[model samples]
Target: MEPDQVLSVTELTREIREVLQGHIGTVWVEGEISNHRLQGSGHQYFTLKDAGSQLSCVMFRGARSGVRLSDGAQVQVHGEISVYEPRGQYQMVVKQVQMKGQGSLQARFEALKRKLHEEGLFDQDYKQDIPKYPRVVALVTSPTGAAIQDMLNILTRRAPWIHVLVFPVRVQGQGVEKETIRALEMLNRAEAHGLPVPDTIVIGRGGGSIEDLWAYNEESLARAIFASQIPVISAVGHEIDFTIADFVADLRAPTPSAAAELLAPDVTELKRHFESLSRRLGGQVMTLLDRHEQTLDFIARGALKTAPAYQLQTAEQAVDDLEDNLKVAAKEQLRGLGDLIQERQQIIVEHHPRIMLMEAAHRLENQAQQLQQKISHKLERLADQVTSRAQLMKHLGPESILARGFSYTTDAQGNVIRDAADVEPGQTLVTRLQQGQVTSTAV
Candidate 1:
């Protein structure tokens, strides 16, 4: 126990570790997390601090899998204290982590929100449109709640014609989700059974805490809202309150009365619209009548020619003109016929057979002279062509070819052979000469 008996650095650190580990054993430390680092080895290291002090902490992977950790989050950690031998530093080895108080509820809320978001339940593409003018609004909530009465009052004041069908269900506590889901199913079933189907559905409650309004946040309820064929208007809690139902619904209303206001048409507005439409129709009819009257005036002005006596007089005038035109045309036609007959007679005189024969004989004589000249020209051209052909034949014929010392070979059938491959060894061949062909055979 003297000065010489003092421990070494490692030994001293080890002793301190043992003492702190034994004394602190499995203590609960509440602090805000900072300097958080999650290692690739699945170990999380962080500093847990209060306003006054800070402590190093570590959570090895697989210790608390369900808890999601982040910096600045207030958490209650359950673990034991330990020392890192190399650095001789002490740290809390956390075994379990829990979010504290309202943080806990908020954590769960955010967690569920993230889960539903990842599931595409919060997708706007899947959201339906709320009915603009719902004729039958199906109300799903507590029959005793104030939301239903407010909605009823609003609907009554705004649109007395819209029929509201109420389906009573618990809006909070145990079995609320199940009851709501069951009610939705029942309404859908009724519609499928050919009953009065709701054009729209209103699900809401009065303002309350997140816990009080948690029925609307249930996953099954959100799914039910998404699956509903009838457009859903979610009006849970107050304007400030938001639940999962708000995200999944076809339309989210700030309050129950707001839902009614959205679904119904104001009677005053409708009355104004009706008056405007009636005025427009009256104006259009008056305009149409004016057009008809103008058209009738135009017809009256032009209808003078439509009188029977006027029509008959017009027909008589037309007949007189037609008669005059016919007479003129007949006289002109007779004149043309007489001229044609005179022309035919002149033609007959001019084309007497004797005169025609004389003209024909003169033409025949001229043609005969032309034909003789053409025959002479043709014979001269033929003689030139024959002489040229003879010269070409003299140069190209076999006799000239033989004189040039060139020879061609043919088979006995007189087919000229150009390639040696075309002749077999025993095939009879003829050597074509200018004078005659020489017969040959294979050896």
Candidate 2:
């Protein structure tokens, strides 16, 4: 505060930067991006502007983690305000970036929405239908918030005895997303632990700013909602508020009261419906009975013929005819029995002892003749084969040649003498004739 005090340009800039950083911290500023430029150092420089004002901003490549934006696009910059000493200018050093106009919360929400939507998390086929009258309704939200009370009141007014369990959660601030996810998973586990499991769940909180509602927009909560075994109803904020949880839930209720209405049927209306159904059923049953009674009356009126005596006479005539038929049948049976007896007598005569003996002797003679023929045929085949073999032996062996008066001469050693040099002078030789072997001396 002294007038004699002097400050260097660098010092002044540094001081101003510190003041801005302390006051602004990391603030979110929304505007359209213009003069967007990328540097070789993997950093981006841009100016954020609106219809009335513009602000300088710089974002390092690390902060550009999502879809890239062009110059004419609206965006939001989350960074700290700082003064650049060299340029003597003030700017926001962007730490994070997202599309603007849709709001930072909405931008992140839509991005996550697109990702999960592509994953089929928001597909109608994957969603289960909410029960018209759920036995147990679980509310995953702040227990003390107005939303819970509103839901409880609506449920009580509609279905008087329907059960409601309030599971408390942090719906805003840091770690809110995790807490919400935990509540959902815990309820799912309740059934396995022999505790009450909800048939349907209503998860949300009362309306607030986009920041306050950001927990419902988290990707983790969206995934958890998709995975819940029970059908979920998203009842966050008022009729105008929308979140990622709403899109992913099986049913989306504009308000907590509306969700309660969806889960529980109106008792008065249900009773009226039952009564109407009962009346209709009773009417149908009565009509059927009346029709059956009319048929019975008609049948009773025609139980007997108009001339009952004539009908009785006709029945008597039929009995007489049956008796006559029985008598004729008995006579025919007697005739048939007589014929059968005659046939038996003829068969007995034919089966006498002498006749049976003659038949047996004839069969024996025929069998002997057949056996003799088989034996003769077998002997002829054997005789032919024996003669053929004998002829072959005579041709192949020396017997035929010997019988033709030819003889074989062998030396004393039993080797046949094919040449004169094989025989020695005065050596005994064996000369085999047709009938015998002769001994002779060789000169």
Highest-lDDT candidate: 1
Q: Judged by TM-score, which candidate is best?
A: 1
List pairs with backbone clashes in candidate 2: none
In model 1, which runs have C-alpha deviations exceeding 4 angstroms?
1-101, 192-194, 304-443
- Please identify model 2 stretches exceeding 4 Å from their true place: 1-103, 304-443
lDDT of 2 by residue, 123-154 (tens): 99988999887888889888788888888988
Error of 1 at 149 (Å): 0.8
Candidate 2 TM-score to native = 0.47
Residue 338, model 2, lDDT: 96
Q: Report the number of clashing residue pairs per model.
A: 0, 0
